[model samples]
Every structure is written in structure tokens, then in C-alpha cells.
Target: MAGGLTRYRHLSRSSSHRQALLRNLVTSLVKHEAIHTTWPKAKEAQRLAEKLITLAKRNNETARRKAQGILYTPNLLMSKLFGELRERYAERPGGYTRVLRTEPKDTYSQAPSALLEFVDSPKDVRFVMTAAAVARDLAEGREHTEITQKNVGKVTRYRAGGKGAFEDMVEKVRALDL
Candidate 1:
């Protein structure tokens, strides 16, 4: 089985159960714009979330119905999904979700945890972190490093007025704890 092609993670669940679990995770992702879970679960859910956003972008009745099937409590989230989220990603092609790995969330299970979020949404931590890094570099009179510049580019690439928004965040971060 080593180095073989695998279509998707089974997550040690039966097919129906796996579908339901991913559906619930995707629903929560839509409602909160972010979630923390085991890295495997996050990656699986990221795939579902990305496809769902693509459906929203399509903006058709059939797509709406398909989206409804995937999203629990579709009535509450559909408008936001088809409206706000659709507009948010209107210009971009793909890769709407970002998953960042972290240390184990709890000591017992010791499972690797990750944060999954839509890239340009209000809950984007990378954007905030980039601003903090920039502000810290400025405070220390250091230049922005290559990694920081790369992060800056990624966080700002598809966001509306992203450069201005990041500049504003840098100022806010600079003003704090300085």
C-alpha cells in the first residue's frame, strides 16, 4: 500500500459516517469561518469547503441545491454562502481555505491539531500575524525578510484593498505594546 494512490482519507469510518462527519465540519466552517481540529480532519474538511465555495461561485439553482445537500442548516447559511462568500471569491480561481498545523490540542490524545479558515475572511490569523511581524520588524528597525514579504503577498493577494488593509493593521499593531 505504500506510495499508492489514495482518493481520500477514510478516517477509520464507514462511508456514510465519513460523509456526515465532513458535512458537519463543513457546516461549522461556514458558520464560524474557522475551526480547530485534528490535522487530518482539517485537511479533509478543507477539501469540502473549497468545493462548496466553488459551488457558490457558480450561482445556479442546481449548484444551490447541491450546496444545500452538503450544508446543514442550509437556510441560514445559503444566503451568506451564495451572496457574501460568492462575492468574496468572485475574482479568485481556487484555494479558498488555509489549514495551519499546531501542537496537540490536548495531552491525552496527542493528535496534531490544525486551524482551518477561509483566506480573506475576518477570522484570518495569518493576515493579523503578518501585520504583527511587520510591526515588530519596524519597531526593531529591521527590514522585512523574504519570508515576511512572501507572507505579505499571500495574505493580501485576493483581498479587496488588501495592501491598504494590511498597512492599517501594521499601524494598529505598531500602536499597541510599543
Candidate 2:
């Protein structure tokens, strides 16, 4: 018998186990900033990577442990997650990782992949601050400083000759228009 054998340790796992495994793997990848694995593994890793990044948007213990629970290796990942990744992904709203195929000329290369490189561009906040300012201004009773444009659609009458309040008003307005 094979002593201490762990054949197919990463693969051949149950669906739930596989999902958890991939989630942990990708979570660690995001925490550490980079990771390498088989092409198919990388695909699964991307899924987890995006999820972890989304979680990173909210830096909290619950989110951290949620990510940790899904991961197989938590120490290395935890360090990178709380230290580098937490700050690096602060301003990014979502969409954390990108997968790129590595090998372009070989058969194995047919399934190659890589993740989107991290960049430190915190100034690029994905929020429309002006919109919020406008809302605040409106709430404060400030008049709209700019002309508002609107697309007025064609009006159709459902009960034109009926004795409804709207129909009565329409008749009055039509009579006035004449």
C-alpha cells in the first residue's frame, strides 16, 4: 500500500469540497498578490479571487474569517490579506482578478492562465461624488443650478370618452387648447 499517499489531493474532490478548496486557493492568491497553478485550477481560482476581492472591499473580521474558512492554507493568506490586499484593494469597487493564459505555443499552454496585476491607484475611486453632492444639495432645498433634460414619451388615452377624473381634466384642457 502507498504509505502517506495523497494522490489527487487537489482534484477528485467532492463538489462542495472542491468549491471550498478552490475558494481557499484563490483567496490565498489574492492575499499573496500572485499565484500559479494548472490552467483549470486557475479558472476556479479566478472565481474565488473575485469573491475574496469583493469581501476585501469591506475590511472586517467576519469577512476575513468567511474567506479563511473557505481556504485550506490560512496563515500565509491571512497575512497578505490583512496587510497588503486589504489596503491595495480599498478603493476598487469590485472585479478583483483577471485570468490570462501563460503558455501560448505548447499543448499545455492551451490551458494557461494568469490573474490581473494589482496596481496602486487609490485616486480612482469608482463613485460619482458629484451625484451625491447634487442629492445633498437637493435635500438642503437648493434649487437645481443647471437645466434638467427629459424625454417625454407619447401619451395614449385608455378611456378617452369615459367619465373619469383624468378624462374630465383632459376634456377641459382640450377645450382650453382650442
Candidate 3:
């Protein structure tokens, strides 16, 4: 069995506990649009999160019930998942979520940690920072630095129009600055 295909990590929990843990993680993700957790949990939850977003896109009764089964607060979060998140990712094909490596949440344990976030939400902090960078250059009458342009490109690629999205984010940042 050494070379046999291994499907998924056990995460050192019973099946029921694992299901509940993942459900809670996905639920929190839907509510807050992001979460920080150990790396393995993030990867496991990412798979479920992707499937749930696909279900949200379907926007049917069956899909709703299936999503409900996976969420802890289905009644409260269903709309966000099926409405805003649904439309956000509509133009795009897949990859509704992103996981980033981060400093360990528990220094004592030294477990690998990551941030799991829904892409293209209303207030994406990463996009905001990238927008701020571009806005600052524009204000100073300077050309877009290579790093700023790269950041903008990364922020806007998944968006329908990269320019529009980046511009919109810059506008939002400016508005906040006022």
C-alpha cells in the first residue's frame, strides 16, 4: 500500500469531528470572507469551499440544500454565498478562493499556517494595498513602478476588466483617504 493513491489527509481527527471542523471553517469563511488556519486545514477547506461556490452558481433548491449541509449557519450566510459571491465569480470559470502562507498562528506548536480568503469580495485588503500603491504613484506624477504594475496585474487578472477593477479599487482608496 506504500505506493497506492492517497485520497485526502486524515488531519488526525475522527470522521465526524473532521466534518464539523471543515463545516465551521467554511462557515466562518463565508461570513468573514477570509480565515487563518493551519495549512492542511486550509487546503482541505479550500476543496470544500470551491465545491460550495460551484453550487452557489447553480442557484437551485438542491444546490442550496447541499450547501446548507456543509455550512454551520446556512440561514444567515446563504444569501452572501448565492447572491454576492455568486455574481462576483460568474464571469470567471473557477478558483473562487485563495490560500496564502503566513507566519504560524501558534508559535509554540510551530504548525504551518495559511490565510484562506474568497477572491473578489467587496473589500479585498490585498487589492486595496495594490490600488494604494498605484494611486500614490499617480498622485506624485510618477510612472507606475514595475512592482506596482505587477501587483495591479495580479489583483485584476481574475476580474473581468483588469483596468476597471484596478481603477475602481484606486478610487475606493482615494475616497477613504478623503
Number of the top candidate by lDDT? Answer: 1
Going through the candidates in the order shown, the clash numbers are 0, 5, 0
Alpha carbon deviation, residue 36, candidate 2 (Å): 3.6
> For candidate 2, what is the lDDT?
0.52
lDDT, candidate 3, equals 0.88
Task: For model 3, state the Cα shift of residue 9 in Å.
Answer: 1.7
Model 3 lDDT per residue over 15-133, tens place: 99999999999999999999999999999999999999999999999999999999998889998999988988887799888898999999899999998998877556678878898
How well does candidate 1 match the true structure in TM-score terms? 0.96
**lDDT sort, best first:** 1, 3, 2
Give the least accurate 10-residue stretch of model 3, judged by summed lDDT. Answer: 120-129
lDDT of 1 by residue, 33-124 (tens): 99999999999999999999999999999999999999989999999999999999999999999999988999999999999999999999
- Candidate 2 per-residue lDDT over residues 1-178, each given as its tens digit: 7577753345667978887767756665655555656566766666667777666667788888886776667776676666667666665566555454555334654645443333322211111122333344445677645421110010112112222433344344445545
**TM-score, prediction 2:** 0.47
Whole-model Cα lDDT of every candidate shown, in order = 0.96, 0.52, 0.88
Ranking by TM-score: 1, 3, 2
Write down the TM-score of every candidate: 0.96, 0.47, 0.82
